[model samples]
Target: MVAQQHGRRGAAFAAVTMAGAVAGVVATTGCSGEVGATADDRPAGGPRVVREAADVLLASGSSKARTSMEMAAGGTRVTIRGEGGYNFAERIGRLKVVLPRDPAGASEHRPITELVAPAALYMKNRGAGVPADKWVRVDATTLEDGNLVTGGATDPLAAAELLRAARNVTFVGSQDLAGTRVWHYRGVTDIGEAAKVASPFARGALNAAAKGFAKDVVPFDAYLDDEGRLRKVRHRFSYLNQGRTVDVASTTLLYAFGSAVSVQLPPAADIFAGKIGT
Candidate 1:
């Protein structure tokens, strides 16, 4: 389970996954839009609606941060485990990922891969000159693919769809982050899906780790603060590969809003792109 990027985009998926999660990229829905809640939407007496802090939102532009993730998958008899790290800034980004070799079944250990980039993600194992399409758009910055909207138009949420799909959300509440109050929630996720989105690691790694993981049992925690300004998340994942079990766990923090410390959107795309790379 070496940590290398495949496909045209290499580790861009992992970069985007980390960037979006730490940035609190809230897609601006229509003012009159309605939100859909999960079965656990009602959380006893938690804060239903929390106000976004203006200063915190503004500071989210191009903030630098780091993240570490762990994952494990398997069933009944076998399991495997791995860990990943990411560093994100408006101008540059880097990721280091490592996974177990045999997990609990075999005796092979996996290798580690490091990715560094300014604009595009690098897949060291896949060779150079590969285009990271999904991670780095060439002509124009558009919303991420698979984002659902009324007119099928590209919007912020479209860019954020990558993160939203990482887990199954159940409830959304409110909490304090960076001194700002925000909305928080919890749910479940398919560890495989999230790993692919966040690390650019292979899916087979998760499958191999899970001897019989027909169902996903990963737990997810998130906080959407500042009226969609910033979000913080944590994931608890486990899997069994071969005859052993490995545990991968991690936490993520993001800031999205206000100003850019690094990237400046095109004049025409500025408003839509919001404040980024400050």
Candidate 2:
């Protein structure tokens, strides 16, 4: 199935999904008093507790991630199968995408890789006219000038923002996921509220990508490790697709903590920094 390919926003989701599996995100600054994780002095559940654990996890070194997203009701089944990891302290990461063969045609599947930093984003086999074995370098500053997500939010880092804006956090029961013990938490969030909060990666650099997403509260279930880091996340939500609400169910699994994730800028001679359309 053909997916509504979002541009920079898609990249942003890729990053945050990686982050959710890797590091996590900053705290919710706007609703500081209203939303915050519990201090070590007190134990609490909900958004605050989950946020703190997420923050700790996100701040850690590196992690291995497995992510998959599907649009409910015959939507496209998204797969991100590879060794994706990041270094939150350094603000850099890489993703090796091993896509499955297209069901419509007997085409070979090629793995695509990406290296993302605070300043630029690099990708392989992204768009037409891109040179072979070359990484497309797009300035993070100019990404929002174009239609990254048609009739959607521009914030490339929407996932981080969405996590920060999550509310009504409550502690659910515990369970074993992927052979790991985890604490489950549930919450609702106004995905767009992150636009108001400042982030080194997001902030003013985004448009309202959340506009097309269904305004009704979207709920998510997050599994946290003993260290309070997010180990797995599953959410069922819908966003407006071509003026119609399309349900999207996504699951992200994170493991291999403290793995070495080193990302460096590619050779300038082999880079393509231009308008990217995929």
Cα lDDT of model 2 by residue, 1-278, tens digit: 01123354344333222221111121112211112234552245546656554356557767766555443323334333444776665666676655444545476445657665644556677555566777766554444322122111111123334466678887666666666666777887654564455364654333343443455456777767677777766655555433556555555566788988777778877776554443
TM-score for model 1? Answer: 0.37
Scored against the true structure, residue 133 in model 1 reaches a CA lDDT of: 25
**Please, what is the whole-model Cα lDDT of each candidate in the order they appear?**
0.31, 0.51
Off by over 4 Å in 2: 1-43, 72-82, 118-120, 138-161, 205-208, 211-217, 273-278
What TM-score does candidate 2 get on C-alpha atoms?
Answer: 0.69
Tell me the number of clashing residue pairs for each predicted model. Answer: 38, 10
Per-residue lDDT value at 174 in model 1: 44
TM-scores of all predicted structures: 0.37, 0.69
- Which candidate tops TM-score? 2
